[model samples]
Target: MEVSPIWSSIVTAAGGLLTGLAGTSGPLWHQRRALARARHAAEHDTTTGLPNRRALTAAVTRTVRRATPFGLVMLDLDGFKAINDTFGHEAGNDLLAEVGTRLAHLGPPVVMAARLSGDEFALLVAGGSDEIAAAAHAAWRAVSHPPVRLGEQAVPLRASVGHTTATLGISPRNLLHQADTAMYQAKQTGGGVHGATEPGPVTDPPPGTRRRDLRHPH
Candidate 1:
């Protein structure tokens, strides 16, 4: 996929600027939010029309600083490669676009949703443990319920979710990593949702599975 040079430049500049201003005071924080909103296009996925990885990181970082309680849910489709291999990449992409749309309208507690490359997506929400669990389950149902149609092909999609709740003093990277780890566990023990209550070693994706990229927006 040939990305627009304009899009690339905007993302680079905005992400670098935000990362550099990590510890700025008062007015600068407001400026950060303004910059993020103003340049939202730069940080959104062209295929899914959702925030990309960089946007999610910035939002999570800001929430951490405010000591806000939030939840992080990481989702990855199960057996996605088989679908692409059997049906085609176009069908896979269509299914993902539908999944993205469903994720975006989760409403209430879900404050942000983004595609984190490949078949992985993440959701950030304002909530406590119980609320976060409920929200994650709701999202899982949203993704897994309907059979996604790509032309004549009716594809049944299944996704695994890894979720965690954060308070204060936790870095955005740590929060994402913990959730990612739990997500791997979910995939390991038959796809469903897993909560990150205990830390463990990272698990590999299931055997015989090869990762591939499906999005190529020109």
Candidate 2:
């Protein structure tokens, strides 16, 4: 029997549609895979490639539940804002990236750095209070070593560190808060690093600004 022209046209259209879909399939699959990786990268630190705040918080919660002891260090770059203002943001970003690299080099129990935002960052060390302190000191030294080689004068940087530790006790959030307070105290006492559970108040006087009492601003 002879096929009608309408029937032949319908079959041809169906075949074309199927071929188009088949041609697009590979690209669609690739797009889906790329999106998944992007999502994972967003949840991690851009510089250190460590877990970002979201991931870190989840990990901290798990660590708390498991009663795993760890140390926390909240750090603030001393002259970061000024540095950025003077040189430019590119330089500033480079400095932060370098800091992240240094932290990654320290390894677990030694350092886990995350740029909380701008010149502010945090570190998680898997050890006791003493180890946390030592780590903080080492971090401070590393940061203050010399200016980064950004084709500019050596850009000297210093960090104020606050530290707290728990040997399978206390929530990670609370420990982080304690470290934050200590870091501020370091600022008040005039440059250098400080370690404590609670820092009195913001003591770091502004440049060319002096205070009589160690607690002068108080």
Candidate 3:
């Protein structure tokens, strides 16, 4: 069979064009996917798949800017150091991940759950005092119940939670500090939920008075 040179050239050029488009688009697609992954990793805690402190700060800032009524709950796991020391950091990490899962699923009136740092987390709640208090108590029960099993060990979890409703003129830092202060107070009183007494702007804890220093020994 004989084919026209011009027709064959047209077909060959079309094939090359399609091949070139694929070669160009494939890397572009992969580059876009990589960028998305980087952005997600930047905003998320790798261990628990929850929003990190940076993301939580951004959320608080946005909420405050919009003048939305909301609440912040700060929670710190009790005796976390003892868990790390006894069962190893792996077990501790596993427990933290489990806690994150529980908090993330707390449902309604609870807007977002974030991991602030090691063994510490925050919940962004929406509503008035009653709603906020309900969410805080629910979070405490969710974290403490049923126990998390790491290998052959069934580990019990306990946390001190401090929650505060946002005020008219509260900065993001002050709001977080207020919640943290309440959490510290809860820790001081043997670990339970505590509400912030100061609804106005608050100061950071004094030097050497960090909450980590107040962690109860197991």
**Top candidate, metric TM-score:** 3
**Which regions of candidate 2 are displaced past 4 Å?**
1-32, 47-50, 167-169, 198-218
lDDT of 3 by residue, 5-101 (tens): 9999999999999999999998999999999999999999999999999999999999888887899999999888888899998888899899999
True-vs-predicted CA distance for residue 52, candidate 2, Å = 2.7
Compared with the true structure, what per-residue lDDT tens digits does model 1 show for residues 1-218? 99999999999999989977775666787999999877887899978999999999999998988887887998898888788888788877888889999999999799999999888999998979887888889889999888888787677889888899995799898888778877777877788999986755653446543222211223
C-alpha lDDT of all candidate models, in order? 0.83, 0.70, 0.88
lDDT of 3 at 9: 100
Predicted structure 3: lDDT: 0.88
Q: Ranking under lDDT, best-scoring first?
A: 3, 1, 2
RMSD of each: 15.7, 7.0, 3.7
Q: Name the runs in model 3 displaced over 4 angstroms.
A: 1-20, 199-204, 207-210, 213-218
Ranking by TM-score: 3, 1, 2
Candidate 2 per-residue lDDT over residues 15-114, each given as its tens digit = 9999999999999999999999998897777755655767666666776786756777767777677888888888777888888777656665764567
Model 2: which residue pairs collide? 69-168, 147-154, 147-155, 187-204, 188-203, 188-204
TM-score of each: 0.74, 0.72, 0.85
Model 2 residue 55 distance off true place after TM-score fit, in angstroms: 2.7
